[model samples]
Every structure is written in C-alpha cells, then in structure tokens.
Target chain A: MANSVTAAKATRGINKTIIYIVCIGLAVLSILPFWIMFVNATRSTAEIQSGLSLLPSTHLKTNWDVLTSKSFDPLKGFLNSFIISASSTALSVYFSALTAYGLVVYNWKWRQAFFTFILCVMLIPTQASAIGFYKFMYQLHLNNSFLPLILPAIAAPAMVFFMRQYLLSTLSLEIVEASRIDGSGEFATFNRIILPLMTPALATQAIFAFVASWNNLFMPLILLTDKSKYTLPIMVSLLRGDIYKTEFGSIYMGLALTALPLFVIYFLLSRYIIAGVALGGVKE
Target chain B: MRRKGTINYAKYGYIFSIPFVLVFLVFALYPTLYTAFIGFTDMKGVIPKPVHILDNPFQNFKELIFDNASFRQSLSNTFILWITNFIPQIALALLLTAWFTNQRLNIKGQGMFKVLLYMPNIITASTIAVLFSTLFAFPMGPVNSLFDALGWSDAPIQFLQQKNTARGIVSFIQFWMWYGNTMIILIAGVMGINPALFEAAAIDGASGFQTFFRVTLPSLRTIMLFTLITSMVGGLQMFDIPQLFITPAGGPDNATLTTSVFIYGQAFKGAYMYNKAAAASMIMFVIAAALAALMFYLMRDRSEGQLRKKLRAQKKAAKAAARGM
Candidate 1:
C-alpha cells in the first residue's frame, strides 16, 4: 500500500509537470507572432528579409521616419480611430444603460414585447444590411461622415441585451422609488443614481465596444474613401497593398502602431475583459 | 389630491425608450428592410440612380444561386474556412480548458496563461492579417529565410500565391486568435458545474477523464450549444483577415473569398452590383436567422415542458378517478 501511494504521488507530479509545460508552451506560441512583429518593427527591411531575429534592433527611429514620410500616417489614424471608438463607445454604453433602465424600472405596457424586439434585433448580423445601409447613407449624404458610424451605435442591441441582463440582476426598484419620492426627475435619477450603480457593467461594455469600434474595418473601409479620414485598420490595409513601397520595417511599425493601443488596453484591463467574456458566456 | 397621488409614471419608460427605438428604426430596422427591397431592384453604381424593381423579383437571387460561380465558390470557401478553423479551435480549447480546470492538476498561473492566450484576440484583425502576411512574405520573408537557414526547403515557397497554403494560413490565424476565447468560455462553463457532482463521481471510483466526460460535459451542454451557434453566426460574417491578407483581395483563386467578401466585392469592388450584393446579404441573413431559431429551439427548457405536461395529465387522471368514484 505504501509503495503504491508513493508511485501514485510520483505519477501525479509528472502529470502536473507535463500540464505546466503544455500551458507555458501554448502561452509562448500565443505571444510569438506579436514578438516577431515587434522585433521586425525595430529591424530594417534588409535585416528583416535576411532572417528573423528574436531581439529588438536599433533602427526604430529610421522605421518611424520612413513610416511618417509615407502616405500612411499612424498619428492621424490613431486620432481618427480614437474619435470614432470613443464617441461610439460612449453612446453605446450610456444609451444601452438608459434603455435597459427603461425596460427594468417602469411597469409599463409593451415592456416585454419591446425587450423581445431588441433580442430579435440582436440576432440580425450587421453585415446583412451593409449594402442598403451604404446606399441609405449615400442618399442621406451621410457617407464619408462620422455621424453615420457613431450614431448607429446608439441602438446597439447586444449592448442593450447585456445591460438589461445586468440590470435585471443588480437593480433595485426601491432606489428609483426613493429618488422619485425626493422629487428627482426620471432622467436625473438615471444620470445620477443609476449610472453610478452600473459603473462595473458600463466599464466592461465600454471596453468591448471600444475594441470593437477600433477594430471595425468593414464600415469604415466602405464609407470613408478619403485618405485623410482613414482609420488605423484602413491604414494597415493600405500598407499591405503598397507592394512597390514595401518597407518591411516601416510596415511592421504601422501594424505595431495599430495594435499598440489595444495591447495597452488589454494589459491594463485584462481582468475585467476576461471576466466580462466569462460572464457573457454564462449568460448566453 | 387623489389625482395627484395617481400620477402615471409609465410615460417615463417610453420617454427613455424613444432614443433606442428611434435609432433602431432609422438604423437597424430600416436598413434591413431597405436591403431586402434592394435585393428585388436593379440598383448599381457609385452614383445614386432610380432603382427599378426586377421583372422577376427573384432575378438576382436566381442568378446568384444558379449562375454566379464566384458567389457559389465564396459560399463554399466560407464554410470550408470556418469548419477547418473551428475543428482545431474547439479541440485545442477543450483540451486547454480540461487542463486548466482539472482539480487534480491544479494548474498554477492560469490567469497569466489566459491573459497571454487571449492577447491575440484584442488586436485588430486587419493588423493581425497584415502581420501574418508580412511574416509569410514570399522569397525573402522571415518564414522563408528561417526555412532556408534550417535547410527545410531548396526554394522559397510562394505561400500567398498557392490556394491551399493560403487558405491553411488564414485558417490557422483564425484558430490561433479564437481558441483562447473558446477556452475561456469553456472554463467558465466547467467552473459553473457543482462540485458535488465531481465529488459524487470520485466516490463512484471514476477517474479524472471519466468525471469530466460524465459530470462536466453533461453540465456544459447549454453553454457549448451557445458557443457553437454564436461561433457559426460569427463565422458566416468572416471578412477582415481574408480581405486584407493578400492583394487584389481574397487571395489566389479566391480561396479565402468569404460570403462577406463576396458581398463586399459586389457592392464596392468591380462593377458595383448593389442589387446582387443585397440579394447575397439577404440569403446570408436568412441562413443566420434560421440558425438562431434552431439554437433557441435547442436551448428551450424541454424537461420543464415535459414536467408541465405530466402534471396536466396527472390532474386529468385524478379528476376522472373522482368522477368514477
């Protein structure tokens, strides 16, 4: 019995070691591409073409200069992306919360029906309406404008669904009643009392919305034809197509720049993002 | 005083709901209907023109379904790519989730591992696509140079030029980017299972594998179904990577031409066939709606419905017995 127990313990240790090795191996694989991209960004086109180096080189300044001199402007792209993502995220989160609050608070007729309608809306993929939306925007003279891109976010059904689910579990009616009793207007109560209560959900949804909007290539690619108004993804895409001007270092630099903000955001709020995904899965 | 006390506050709900409702009507609902309408009309070009309803209402749809080789190839390619990526993705995700969630293994630094794994997903897909394209650049790329140095090949491989390899790389990228996300969701599902179930399985002399199969997998049915349907829906809309990975878009021979890419090409690219694109979009929308409906049907509480049926039957039987007595 004693011999068998020792053998079992030894086997257990072996299994744990194997598991750790596999986990670490995958983690490395996950990060290897990004590492190569960053490393390549620092090396010149010739060095990058010659071979792969795991180490960062001294050509970062040169690459940045090369990148800036090209039609692809990282700073402008970043500014454009920031403007779109920030405005859309703000609209998506705030309005979603308000809509969810509306669904939850008042014992109104058509509440359940409206919630179901929103849920149905969630099932429709955005790509399905791309052509018509493009045409409609063109007809309205809203194409090439940020208003069409940002305004549609106000009706983000998935965000509304998430917010509604969050409110259903966390919101208490007594607070709304209390605010009402104290003569606070409905909108004021929502802005003051309710928005604070939804800070956690709002933050999680805001991050998701921001990332999504930032990474959105389809709409902007179709809508914005002007080079000056191009977002980061579009700039990266432009770099891909410019084979004659293939400065590998500068191109990699552009890709890295496009991904840098996301990396920073992910690193800072990974805990919340992961938790949000997990929660989203469970709720689904 | 009674009237003041009886003030109806329901209007507040409508007031708050108006913004969302109006936005949805203008943006979501109207666009969808307009797309459907466009599918039936002959609207094409960069400049706006009066759209004429097709003589046969199904002219674009019939032509696309029957005649258009490119659209059909795109449809098949989309499925092929999605399946190739999804199979490996779910397999790796399940394996990782099993390892991570195993109580016996009790993996350390799971948080750090998860963070690293999910890192790729947060980056822009366009950037990721371009990064991979550069990494696998022909003749003098890092991949080619590495192969040359290692004596793996006599000549540099034209990765993007070849159809199969290009599709494979695209599939690999998709798998790499998403497997971690799937694993995270699966881990959450596993965590949600009651510990008592595992304890009971252990008491029954079940091994770790047996416990996972019996307790974990059984309990994860709902979440797994959710994952599967959502992944399917998302897969149907796959666009960015395939679009930006190669020049002239859609890689060599259009091997990576997804349905979305096809739609994009129709409306935005050569010839600007807005009506045809709308028709394709409508088809995709219909398929997606069907899948969602199927998911809802599968996810319904069948056991509860059965239990209610049984209760009603029992009530009828009890009443009949009383009447007989």
Candidate 2:
C-alpha cells in the first residue's frame, strides 16, 4: 500500500511539473512579440534591420523624431481614436444596460419579440450592410464626420445580449419595485439607483466596447476622408502601406504607442475582463 | 394582490428601448435591406443614381462568382487561412484547457499565464499587423537575418513577397492571437463539468487521458460547438490583419486577400463599384448563414434521436395492435 501511494505521489509530481512547463512556455510565447515590438521601438532603423534582441537601445528619441517628422501624425490619430471610442463606448454601455433593464423589469407585450429580434440581428454580419451604409452616409452628408463612428454604438446587439444576460443573473426586480414605490421617475431610478448596482457589468462591457471601438478599422476606413480625422488603426495602416517609405523605427514606434494604452487599460481591468469572458462562456 | 400605489412600468419599457429601436431601424436593418436591394441594381460611385432592373437581376452575382477571379481567390484564401489557423488553434486550446483544469496538476501562476496569454487578443489587429510586417520585412528584417545567421539560408528571403509564406505567417498570427481566448472559453467549459464525474472517473481507475476523452469531452460538447461556430464566423469576416499585412490588392499575387478586403476594395477603391460590392457582400452573407446553419444542425442535441426512436416504437405498436384486431 505504501509503495502504491508513493507511485501516485510520483505521478502527481510529474503531472504538476508538466503543467508548469507548458504554462510558462505559452506565457513566454504570448508576450514575446510585444517584447520585440517595444524593444524595436527604441532601436534605430539600421539597428532594427540588423537583428532582433532581448535588450533595449538608446534611440527612442530618434525614433520619436522620425515618427513625428513623417506624415503619419500619431498624436492626432490618438486623439481621434480616443474621442471616437470614448463616446461610442459611453453610448453603447449606458444604452445597452438601459435596454437590458427595460426588457427584464417590465412585463411589456413586445418584450420577448424585441429580445428575439436583437438576437436575430446579432446573427446578421455587419459586413453585409457596408455598401448601403456607405452610400447612406454619403447622402446624409455625414462623410468625414465622427457621427458615423459614434452613432452606430446605440445598436450594439452583442452588448445588449451580454448585458441582458448579466442583468438576468444579477439584477432583482424588487429594487425596481422599491424605487417605483419611492415615487422616483423610471429614468431616474435607472440612472440613480440601478446604475450603481451594475458597476461591475458596466465596467466589463465598457472595457470591451472601448477596445472594440478603438480597434475598429473597417467602418472608419470607409467613412473618414481627412487625414486629420483618421483613427490610430487607419493611420497605422497608411504607415504600413507601400506608397510611402515608412521607416522601420517610426512604424514600430507608432505600433508601440498605439498598443501601450490598450496594455495599460487591460492590466488595470484584467480581472473584470477575465470574469466577463467566464460569464459569457458559462451563460452561453 | 394589486399593490396600493404602484405606477405602471410597462410604458417605461418603450421609453428605455426607444434609442435602440431607432438606431436599429436607421442603421442596422435599413442598411441591410438597402444593400439587398442595391445588389440587384447597377449603382456605382457615392451618389444616388438611376438603377434599372434590367434583363439579369443576377448579373452582379454571376460576374462576381464566375468571372471575377479575385473574388474566387479571396474566398479560397479566407478558407485556407481560417482552416490552417483553426486546426492548430483548437489543438493548443484543448491542451491548455486540459492542463489548466487538471486538479492533480495544481499548476502555479495560472492567473498570470492567462493574463499574459489573453493580452494579444486585446491589442488592435492593425498594431499587430504593423508589428508583424516589420518582423517579416524584406532582407533586413529580424526573421530573415535570424534565418541567415542560423545557416538555414545564406541569402535573406522576403517573407511577405512569397505567396505561401505570406499566407502561412498570416495564419500563424491569427492562431497566436486567438488561441488564448479559445483556451479561456474551454477552461470555463471544463469548469462547468460536474466534479463528481471526475471523482467517479478516478475511482474507476481511469487514467487522465482516458478521463479526458471519455468524460470531459462528452460533457463539453455544447461549449465546443459554441466556440467552433463563433470562431468560424469570426474567421470568415477576417479583415484587419490581412488588410494591413499585404497591400490593398492582397499582394504577393493577391494571396492574402480575404472576402471582406475584396469587398472593401470593390466598393471604395479606384473604380468604386457599389453594386459589385453589395453583390459580394450578399454572397458572403449567404455563405456565413449557410455555414452557421450547418454547424447548428451538426451540433444539435440528441433529443431528436430519442424522438425518432419513440416514434418508431409507437408505429410498431400500432401495427401490432392492428394485426391483433
């Protein structure tokens, strides 16, 4: 019996060691490209061309100079992306939560139908609507404006679905009942009372919506015409285009700068993000 | 059971959902319907022009699917990239899921590894594309230099300039970016499985691999289906990485051009044919819908099987009763 127990323990040790090695190896592979990107951002064009390394260099300022001197305009791109994504996220999160709450709390006639409609809409790929959307925006004289980027957030079916799932799991109608008893307006109850209760869900959706909108390339690429109005992704694409010389150091700097904000945001709210994914997976 | 002074809450539902309803009408539904209509018409440029329903309503589709080699190439490239990435991606995700959820393993730093792994997914595709293009840049790039130093080749190869290499790199990047997300979802799936089942498997003297195949995978069927369908849909719409990696024309002889990129080019690029783009978009929609339906059918619950068996038994009993009568 003792020998059998010892063998079991030996197998456990082997399994644990194997798991550790795999986990650590994958973690390294995951972060290697980001490390290379940051490292290359500090090197000169020639140095970057020379070879790859695990060390940093002293030419970050030179890269910054080259990046700013080029027509890429990283600062403007950052500002444009920030404005578009922030407004879009705010619109999507608040409105989606409201919609989810509305569907959950009220015993309206069309509630189930509306929910099913949103689910069906979720299945229709947005790429199918690109042609008419482009033409419609042009006719509306909204081309080159941020309205096209910001306004569509109101119809984010995925966020609506997720928020609805979150609400169904966590929210209690008794609070809405109590708030109504206190003579509070419906919108006021939603804004003042229910919104505070939904902080975790809202934050999760906010991060996701922000990242999605910030990384959006297709819509903005078609809508915006002015270089001054370009988002970070659009500008980065242009930099990588073959029309320009697009210096290696400058491109890396542009990429690093663009990704840094995402990394910071992700690291800050990673727990919520991870939990959100779990929530989504389990509910689905 | 009527309350004393509760106000009617049903009205507020309409009020709260007004923004969403309006947005959907103006943006989502209308555009889709309009695109379908425009697919049948020959409208070019940005303006509203006269579109006659000429002899061939299906002309745009026929020209696109049959005559347009670029469209066909894009379709094939998309499938090739998605399948290549998906095979290894699902494998790695399954391995990671199995390892992370193994109770006996008791792996350390699982949270840190998860955070690091999922980091690539959160970064913008454009940024990743730019970073990778530089890494694979001609002659002077790090990959080529490393290959030369390792004596794999004396001369530096322009990785992006070769068709097969470009497609392979793009596929690899897609795999690298998505495998983490897939692993997390699978871990959630494994976690959802009953602990009693694992204990039962252990008591039966089943090995880890045996337990995984016999118990874990069967329980995870629904979640696996969910992941597969989602990944398939996302893969079909892949645009940003391929768009930025290759030139607008899907360069190296249009090897990396996805359908979405092709549609974008047709709509917005030099010639600007909105009609053709709409037709292509409609084709993509059909393909995506058909694929999703097939996956759903394939992964449907076995209640149908039970229903069929029940019906067969009922029919046999009825026949036996008739014969006895």
Candidate 3:
C-alpha cells in the first residue's frame, strides 16, 4: 500500500509539471508575433523572406538609417505620436480621476444617475458609435486635426472606472474630513492631498491611457487623411504603400520604428499594465 | 468634507470637474446624439446631401438588416465569427489562469509571462496587420515555410485572399489579441478566491479537477459571464484585420467586409451613402444595445439566484449553531 501510494504521488508530480510546461508553452505562442517582428526588423528583407535567422543581424543600422531618414521623418512621427498620446493621457487621467473622486467621495445630486450612466456605457464597445463618430467629426470640420483624436480621451469612461478602484483602495473619507477641518478647500484638498495619495494609481491609469492612445489606429485611420499629420504607424504604413508598393526592407524598418515606443514603454512600466487591466475587469 | 472652516470647497469642486464636462460634451455625448439625429435624415456623406425626409428610416433600416442580402450575410457571418473568436479566447484564458494558480507550475517569472502575452496589445493595429501580412504572405512567409517543412502542402496558400479563409484568419487574430486580456482578468479572479475553501477540498481527498469544478467555477461565475458578454458585444465589431487583409480592393469578393467596414465604406470609403450608413449605424447600435441589455439581465438573474442560495445556507447554518448552543 505504501509503495502504491508513493508511486501515485510521483506520477501526480510528473503530470503537474507536464501540465505547467504545456500551458506556459502555449502562452509563449501568444508573444510569438513580437519575436517574429523583432527578427524581421533585424535582418534584411531578402534574408527574412529566404529563411528564419535565429540571431540578430548586422544590417540593423542600415535598416535603422532608412527608417530615420528624412523620407521617413521618423522623429516627426514619433513627436506626433508622443504629443497626441501625452495630451490624451493627461486629459483622460485628469477628467476621469476627478469624476471618479466626485462619485466616490462626494455627496452630489444625481450621483446614482451619474453612476448608472457610467455603468451603461462601460461595456458598449467603440464599434457601436465608431462610424457615427467619424461622420460627426467630418461634419464638425475637425477631422483633419489631432483634436478629434485627443479630445475624446478626456471622457474615457474606463479611466474613470479604473480611478474609482484605485481611490477606493488608497483613500479614506476621514482624510477628506481632516483636510476640511484644516481649512483646505475641497478642490485644493483633492488637488494637493488626494492627488499626492493617488499618485501611484494615477501612474497606472496614465500609463494605460498613454498606451491606448498610442495604439489607437482605427479611429485615426478613419478620421485623419493627410500624410503630414499621420502618427508613427500611420506614417509608416503610408511609407510602405499608399500610392505604390515599396521595398519590403523599408516597410519592415518602418514597422520596427513604429513598434519601438510600445516596446520601450512595456519594458519600463510592465507592472502597471497588469494592475490596470485587472482593475477594469475585477468588478465585472 | 464641508466642515465649519473649510475654505471655498464648492468653488474648487466645480473647478475640478470642468475638464470632464467639456470633454464629455465635445466628444462622447455630442457625437452620439448627433449620430442618432443624423440617422433620422436621408442625408448621405457629403454637403448638399440627399435627404429623403427625416421621419422615415424604415427603408434604410430594412435594407441594412433584412432586405439587403449582403448586409444580412455579414450579420450572420458576424454572429458566427463572434462565437468562434470568443470560444478559444475564454477557454485559453481559463486554462492559463488555472495553471497560474497551481502550486506546481513553479513558474519562475509568472508576471513576466503575462506581460509578454499582453505586449501585442500595445502595438498599433496597423503594425499588427502589417506583421501578419508578412508572416502569412504567399510563397514567402514563415507559416508557409513551416507547412512546407511538414510536407503538408507543395504550393503556397494565400490565407487572406479567399472568403472563408479571410474571415477565419481575421477572427483568429482577434482571438489572439483578446485572450491575454481575459487571461489576466481570470488570473486575478482566481487569485481572489478563498484559499481555505480550496484547502478544505484537498483535505477531503478531492483532486484539482474536482476542486476547480466544485469551488473555482462557481466562485468565478460572475466574472465568466462578464467576459463572455463583453466578448460578444465587442467581438462582433470585427473591422480592422479584415479591412487590412483585403485592403487596396475593398475586400476580396467582399468576403472580408465587416458591418462597421461596410457602413464606413458607404459613408466615406467609396461613394457616400450617408442615409444608408446612418441607418445601418442605428440598426447596429440597436442590436448592440439589445445584446448588452440581455447579458445584463441574464447576469443579474444568475447572481440574484446565487445570492439567495448563499443567504439560505447561511441562515440554516446560523439556526443549527443556535440550536447546538
């Protein structure tokens, strides 16, 4: 009986290990595209088309040069992406955090109604109004500018929801009461005391908003038409082809350039991504 | 927070909320209401647009939902596509979550794995579409090379050129993008469970499978429903991948045309069909609203029932304890 039990335990251990390996191996397949993208970026397009090269190649600089040259205007595109994403992030975090703070901490008329409005739009995917929004922008005569892209981030409902979660964990009504006793105005207290307390949470949501705005393609695609105003990815795609199909190396180089910000951001702030995603999904 | 000496609290409160109201009015509320208003007109996409009277969108709505065969076909295809995409997304997320929770996975860097999987999400869709374009290009891509190595096929296959193939690959990409998100949520949900209950199950000689079935799934009922419903709402809006796949040609044989894409194509991409586009968008909005309502209704019912059961169990246990005392 002892022998049989011991054998069963060993078998179970082996099976658990196998399951773990298999599951994580499947997860690796999830990131395979990024790996492939990196590989393609490093090699010459000819070498890429020919076969998979396991290691980084020396041709990266030439590819980098073409990508960064005046024709690409890589800096301008990066600057454009940066300006849009940063503005969106600042607007989204400020507005959403304020609304979230009001909803959670204050006693306001229609608070329940306001909350219901927030909840209703929570899961309504962007697709529902995507076309409508595009046409609306066209008529508003704002389609050509970045305002159409950056303005919407201010009312980002998800950011509001995320802020609510963060504030719930970090803030207390007592703190507000104390601030009030100290003769601090509500906004002043919120801006100074609450904002300081909420910094970590703010960072998380800000990163999320930044990444989201940075990655926004469909809206920008349908809204912005001019080549001069294109974000990095948009500019890159235009480089590869809009009038004519170009060389694969330039396009691959363009892809590498476009994807670089996200890669760097990911490496720098990976911890917050998990928290932001989980916070949104937690309640539901 | 308005205590006896708190200085000018109301003024500050109002000040902080201005940016939010400004943005909401300019962006979300304005566009949404304007879209619905436009739906009432027969206006197409350009200036001096054809208006067929505001009161009657019946014809346009009818064309979008039932009368036009292509619209109807895309609708059916979208339904099929949503189900196919969501199945693998939810399934893989659940499996990954369970593995992450398992003591034996012994994974050295679990958080790193999650972050890596989620990396694709940050890249622009154009970049993703472009990456996929190269990865599966005819005669030259690595996927074809792998097929060649396996002797599965002698010739190259243009995966995105054909009708069903294009839809399949597009759906596959959506599934790939969403799974990492769902998996992370499920991981957090699983981690939120009471470890004591799981330990109790183990002491009773219950296997991992039994514990998951008896404890984990039930506890995660709300979250699972949430994932499923949101996926249905969002997955049906397949536009980008299909558009890029069949780009430079409005879609191969129109097989890759999504409803949003079709509406967009009409309104701007091709000849402006504003009234038709607006009508289609209205119909699309109605369907989405209905689906969202239905999910919420169902989810509320399930949770309410579960809540009742939990209350009853607690009441019974309390009574038994009182009697014993």
Candidate 4:
C-alpha cells in the first residue's frame, strides 16, 4: 500500500512539472512580442534594423524627439482616445444596465418583444450597417465629429445583452420592492440602491467597452478626416504607414505609448475581465 | 399584495427604455434599412441621389458579383483567413481549456496565465500589425535572422509581399491574438458543466480522455455553437489587421483584402463608389446571417428535437385516421 501511494505521488509530481513547463513556456511566447516592442521603442532605427534584442538601448530620448520632430501629436491623440473611449464606455455601460434594469423590473406589455428585438439586433454585425451608417452621419453633418462615434454607444446591443444576463443572475426584485416601500423614487432606487449592487458587472462591462472603444479603428477611420481629431490607432497607422520615410524607432515608441495604459489597466482589473468572460459564456 | 400608492413604477420602464429605443431606431434600424434600400439603386456619389427602385436595380450587385475581381478575391480571402486562423485557434483553445480546467491538475496561477495569453487581444490591432510587420520584414527581419542562424533558408522571405506568405502571417497573427479569448470562453463552458457528471464518470472508472469526450464535449455543444457563430460573424467582417497590415489596397495582389476592407475601399478610396459598397455590405450580411441560421439549425436542443418528433408522429396519426386506413 505504501509503495503504491509513493508511486501515485511520483506520477503527480511529474504531471505538475510538465504543466508548469508548458504554462511558463507559453507565457513567454505570449509576452515576447510586447517585450520586443518596448525594447525597440528605446532603440534607434539603425539598432532596430540590425536585429531584435531583449535589451533596452540608450536612445529612448532620441526616439521621443524623433516622434515629435515628425509632428506626431501623441498628447492630442491620447486625449482624443481618452475622451472617446471614456464617454463611450460610460454611455454604453450605463444605458445598457438601465435598459437591462427596465426589462427585468417591469412586467410591461412589450417587454418580451423588446428583449427579443435587442437579441436580434445583437446578431446583426455592425459591418452590415456600415454603408448607410456613414451616409446617415453624412446627412446629419456629423462626420469629422465625435458625436457619431460616442453617441451610438447608447444602443450597444452586446452590452445590453451582457448586462441583461448579469442582472438576471444578481438582481433581486424584492430589493426594488423594499426600496419603493421606503418611498424611494424609481430613478432614485436605481441610482442609489441598484447601481452599487451591480458594481462587479458594471466594472467588467466598462473595461470591455473601454478597451473596444479605445482600439476601434473602423468607424473612426471612416468618420474623422481632420488630423487634430485623430485617435491613437489612426495616429499609429499614419505614423506606421511609410507616409514619409519610416522612422522605425518612433513608430515603436508610439505603439508602446498607446499600449502602456491598457497594460496598466489589465494588471489592475484582470480578475473582473476573467469573470466577464464567464459571464459572456453564460449567454449560451 | 397589491397596495395603493406604494409606487407604480412600471411606467418608468418606458422612461428608462426611451434612450436605447431612440438610438436603435436612428442608428441601427435606419442604417440597415437604408443600406437595403440603397442596394437596389444607383446612388454612386458622395451625396446619395434619391434612390428609385426602377433605376439600375441590379447595377451595383452586377459590379460586386461579376465585374469586380477584387471583390471576389476579397470574399474568398476573408473565408480563407478566417478558416486558417480559426482552426488552430479553436484547437489551441480546446487544449488550453482542457488543461486549465482539469480538476486533478489544480493548475497554479491559472488567472495569470490567462491574462498573459489574452494580452495580445487588448492591444490595438494596428499596433500589432505594424509590430509584426517590422519583426518579420524582408532581409533584415528578426525571423529571417533566426532562419539564417539556423541555416533554414537561402535568403530572407518577404512575408508581407508574397501572396501566400502574407496570408499565412495574417492568419498566424489573428490566431495568436484570438486563441486566448476563445480559451477563456471555453473554460467558462467547462466550468459551467455539472461536477457531478464528471464525478459519476470517474466512479464508473472512465479515463480522463473518455470522460472529456463523452461528458464534456457533448455538454459544451451549445457554447461551442455560440463561439463558432460569433467567430464567423467577426471573422467575416475582419478589417483592421488585414487593412492595416500593409496598405488599404490589401497585401500584394489583394490576397489579404477582407470583404469589409473591400467595402471600405469602395466607399472611401479612389472614386468612392458608395453604391457598390452598399451592395457588398448587403451580400456580407446575407452570408453572415445564413451562417448564423445554419448554426442554429444544427445546434437545436435535444428536447426541441424530441418535441418535433412527437408533433410529426401526431400529424401522421391524424392523417391516417382521417383517411380511414
């Protein structure tokens, strides 16, 4: 019996070592590109052209100077991206949660129909409506403006779907009943009582919405024509495109700059992101 | 339990729903309807002409379907890239899911591994495209340098210049970016499965592989279907990586040009053919919708399947009785 137990332990030890080796090796592969990007950001164009390295070089300041010399307005790009992503995320999460709240709390006549409608819209990919959407924005004279980019978040069908699933799992109608009994107004109950309760869900969706909006290239590429209104991706694309003689170092710096905040956000809120993925799967 | 003056808040539902409803009507429904309407017209200018049904009804589609080599090429390219990326992505995801969720293994720092894997997804696709291009550029690229060190090639491969190589790199990058997300979703599906079923299988002396195939895979059908459909939709509209990879014209001979890129090219680039873009967008929508419907048909529930069987039996029985057989 003791021999068998020892043999079992030995097998488990081997299994554990194998798992660790695979996991760490894969993790290295995952982060290697980003690591190269950061290292290249600190290197000169000549050094980068020579080959890739894991080492940081002494030309970081020079790279920044090159970026500025080339008239790459990273500060403005950052601000524009921040404004668009923040407002869009806030609008998407709040309105989606509100819509989900409405559907859950009320036994209204058209509630089921409205929910089904939202689900149907969820299946219609945004690409399907791009042509008319562009034309519609043109008609409204909203091109080159942030309104078309930001305001459309109010009707994010996927966010609404996610929020609805979250609300179903966490929200209790009795709380609404209790709050109403205590003379809290409907909006007051939602604002004061419910929003706090939905913090975890809100945080997950907010991060997702923020990331999506920040990384979005398609709509902004189509809409914004003014150089000053360009978001980070647009700026990155313009810089990366050998529109002029390519400055490889400067381009890498720009990419590293764009990704830095996202990296920080991910490290801080990764748990919520993992939870959010589970929530996404709950739909099925 | 109905009480008077205790707050009839049902009316506030309308108030809450109004914002979403307005945005949907103006942005979502209107644009889709307009796209459908514009597909049948010859509105080719920056400002749309009043679309009349009788005015060159099939002109845009004729151009998109038959006359345009680039559009046809892009259609095939989108499928090729999606399938190439997705096959490896789903396979890797399944492997990771199986390992990560193995109850016996009890993998340490599972969350850290997941975050690291999913890191590529959060980065801007444009940045990634640029980064990869630079990393794998001809002659002096890191990949080529490594190949030389290993004596693997006579010369550096022009990764983004050649058609097949460009497509391959695009597919690899796409697979690298998305497999993490797919793994997370699949892990969730695995976790949602009843532990008791796994326990029962173990009690019956079934091996891990046997339990996975018999208990886990079948149970994950719905989740797999959901992932497949969403991936198909996203894959069909793939634009950013391919468009940003080299140029908006798509890499060398338009090998990496996705359908959405084609639509963007038509709408925004040289001559700005809005009518042709509308038609292409509509065609893409049909393909996406049909794929979704096919998934739904194939993945219907067993309970629903049984219900249909019973209904068919009852119908046949009723027909036989009516015929006095």
Global lDDT scores for all candidate models: 0.90, 0.86, 0.73, 0.85
lDDT digits (tens) for residues B106-126 of candidate 1:
888999999999888999999
The candidate maximizing lDDT is 1
Runs off by more than 4 Å, candidate 1: B1-4, B301-325
Say what the RMSD of model 2 is. Answer: 6.5
Worst 10 residues of 1 chain B by lDDT: B299-308
Query: lDDT per residue, candidate 2, B237-305, as tens digits?
Result: 999999898765487899999999999999988778888999999998898888677665766558546
| TM-score of each model, in listed order | 0.95, 0.92, 0.88, 0.92
Better of 3 and 4 by TM-score: 4
Note the B-chain TM-score for every model.
Answer: 0.91, 0.87, 0.82, 0.86
Using TM-score as the measure, which candidate wins? 1
What would the DockQ be for model 4? 0.62
Per candidate, native contacts kept equal 0.85, 0.73, 0.50, 0.67
**Residue B50, candidate 2: C-alpha displacement in angstroms:** 3.3
The local lDDT score (0 to 100) that residue A52 gets in candidate 3 is 61
When summed lDDT is taken over every stretch of 10 residues in candidate 3 chain A, the lowest stretch is A239-248
- The RMSD (Cα, Å) of candidate 3 is 6.1
lDDT of 3 by residue, A1-284 (tens): 99999998898779778876875776677667667677667777677667665576767876777665545777778888899999988978777888888877864445546666776677665655665687777768888789988878877776777787677677888999988888887778878888888888789888877877887666777778876677776674565354324345556667778888788888888788777788667773
Candidate 1 lDDT over residue span A14-53, tens digit each = 9888888888898998888899989988999988887889
Tens digits of per-residue lDDT for model 4 on B85-146?
A: 99999998988888888778788899899999887888888888877877786777668877
Tens-digit lDDT track of model 4 for A1-284: 99999998899889789878988987898899899889989999888777768899999999898887776889999999999999999999899989999988885667767877776667777888888998889989998999989998999988888878778778889999898779898889999999899998888889999999999999999999899999998887876556424577887888899888888998898888877876787564
lDDT per residue as tens, model 3, B1-325: 2346534434444455567667777677766776666666776645655455655547677666667876776677777778778898888888777777876446557787788777676677667777787677777777887787778888878876777777787778878788888988888888788889888988898887888788888989888888887877776666656556556523567666677777667777556776677766767777778887877786765644685598579769978987787
